[model samples]
Target: MFITLVTLLEEVKDILKLHGQMLNTLLKNDSMPIMAIPDGVVFPLANVEDVIAMNEKCSDPEFMSAVVAMVGDIGGSSLEDATRRMMKFLMVPELQRHNELAATFNTHSQSCAIKHRQQDTLEVLDLSYNLLEENPALLGGLEKLSTLILDFNNYNSHVKFPYMPSLTALWLNKNKISNLPIIVEEICSKFPNIRFLSMMNNEAAPSYFNGGSLTQYVDYREYVISQIPSLEVLDDTEVQEKERELARKTYRMQRIREGSRKRKELHR
Candidate 1:
């Protein structure tokens, strides 16, 4: 009886070992489950070959969505090459359903030139830390885009906001902006639907705020909020009811002054 019990225990251990080996093999295989990829894997561009392999194992659309969501930047031998590769990858019909995209730390002008055939589904885009002097024509295609992050870019007075009727949020931190009035005018004209705006750490903002004094900051905030009535947030802070009231009064007075100036000019 003792001998039979020992043999049965040995058989159970062997079975458990075999099961562990099988699981490891499945995990190592290219056909591993999509969820197996760590959530922290933000940059799939760092391992394009692995992404390509995963595409072979999974359906193109599934792999494409996963890769698009994970990729941070498209790195290549050159800016043009990277842009071309990114365009080619994104042009895949299966990848069109992705709604969010990040193409930061790349040549913004070059990437913007690459016509994105799948712009319809894109709603949020991060183009930060790139060399973008002006609003690119590529934005015209992304009609549904609501959130655009252009932080750490090279935008200045020469840049104009593209007419994006659906844009609700914009991030312009750490840029070369020096003309607050021009930017506010552009927002009022081009982005009527904007609800959130961030212009922190910009050359224009600090200079306009007179070296970041609280009084100047409040004045700046009031001016911006007045310009864009739909704005609910400014520089990460929510617009309060009192602030809104002040903004409305300021806006009314500014309009009255402008009207008076225009009337005088017309008479002349």
Candidate 2:
């Protein structure tokens, strides 16, 4: 794109747009790669533009849904199709999300303590033993829901949950989840305020009950606690201050390296 400009002033104008007037002091020291130049310019021209466009699109949540709907009309798309075809394939239908919620908690279930069940009344919802798969965005309607239990469900590494800031406790015992990092990333993203979380009996969260070694269990707990600083308890074990400190100390350097790598990539 810069080469297509043809004029020298146009290229200079583009650099000035990024760095204002940095060229004034650094006239002789302006030899830098476009990516390593101003700010966090990790990508070269076209790729960075796409990243900016995607970020803008992400600001509107409904835009991606609309993209998925539109993209479904085209088959045999490339790996970079914005629809996330593989992820869409893994998730159950939107109607299924409603069906699962209805199956677990109905209008009558709310009479005991909560009302306006979809709004702020509901706090604890146990959707255990329901052969669940998708935790749809519809669950976000329960604004005040705190604890969500999905024990013995079909959740895996690909689980994409709705953002529930109020939720603190989550149980996913006896599930098919593996690939610890992927599942942990999804969990932390969706439930930023989670305090008590359990992924016991899954391959990712190995334990004595799950036929995994004691060393593996300790490692899992430390990793999880490190990833989620707000986590008070993991799997039934309390996250002590000493353990948390050790976990952070252990992963801090690794986290820094990962951050650098992510910055190098055009998209996060």
Candidate 3:
């Protein structure tokens, strides 16, 4: 029992040390492999067999419980914190395999800046609180991205993005949007696949749900529903069939006529 406990402690130490190296290197290399070990980390084993073996043993639920039992939890304190970090650190490799990165903050990198090969791997992204006023110069070939969070940005109606056919959800809560039809048309044009959308706290999406007057909220929802035929949820509410039917009856003809007028003006 004593020897087993000592071996477990040693394994935990090695895992944390290697994980620290990986995370530091991953961050510094911008999610790419490091060509050489960075300074300070002394050259060690040439292969990852040791780390893999250690991870497999440490990840066993029974083994984890045994180690924790030996360590003895001390009332939701440092030991728990360290264990939580270890579990999350171990998951980094698995998360990297799927490339489904979410909220990897400080990448303030525009889509054009990321490597082309890595761009399509991104399916979910959170760019919230970035203070962006307009959509960045997003290049083509991001064919897999489906969810985007732009909450707390400074975008207004003039904001625009490259035509993305695969984007299904967008979060634009607490932005600077006052014009309703203009932004709605932009969304329809850009995210032709948008199904879930939120513009809460923007003047354009005013509703009693966020302390806005209830009177015009219905108008807001109806107009948006009329514009985007693919939208399933607006803000926080699911679009009902009855509401959709009413929206179509209310604004479908008006939208068609307006579209016709725009075409005529452009032609002339």
- Residue range 61-120, candidate 3, lDDT tens digits: 665555433322111123224433333333344432332222221123344123422785
Task: State the displacement of the C-alpha of residue 125, model 1, in Å, after optimal TM-score superposition.
Answer: 0.6
Ranking by TM-score: 1, 3, 2
Candidate 1 to truth, TM: 0.56
* Clashing residue pairs found in predicted model 2: none
Q: Model 2, range 186-265, lDDT digits (tens) per residue?
A: 98899999999988889999899879998998889888988999999898889999999999987897889998998889
Which wins on TM-score, candidate 1 or candidate 3? 1
Model 1 spans > 4 angstroms off: 1-117, 207-210, 255-268
The prediction achieving the highest lDDT against the true structure is 3
Arranged by lDDT, best first:
3, 2, 1
**How big is the RMSD of model 2?**
24.3
lDDT of 3: 0.61
Can you write out model 1's per-residue Cα lDDT over 1-268, one digit (the tens) per residue?
1121112222222232334422322223223222334343332322434334443533445544454332213333433333434444433433322222223323233343223225777787766545567566568668898988877677885577679999999998888877888888987888889999999887557534336777768878888888888989999689998999998898799899999999999999
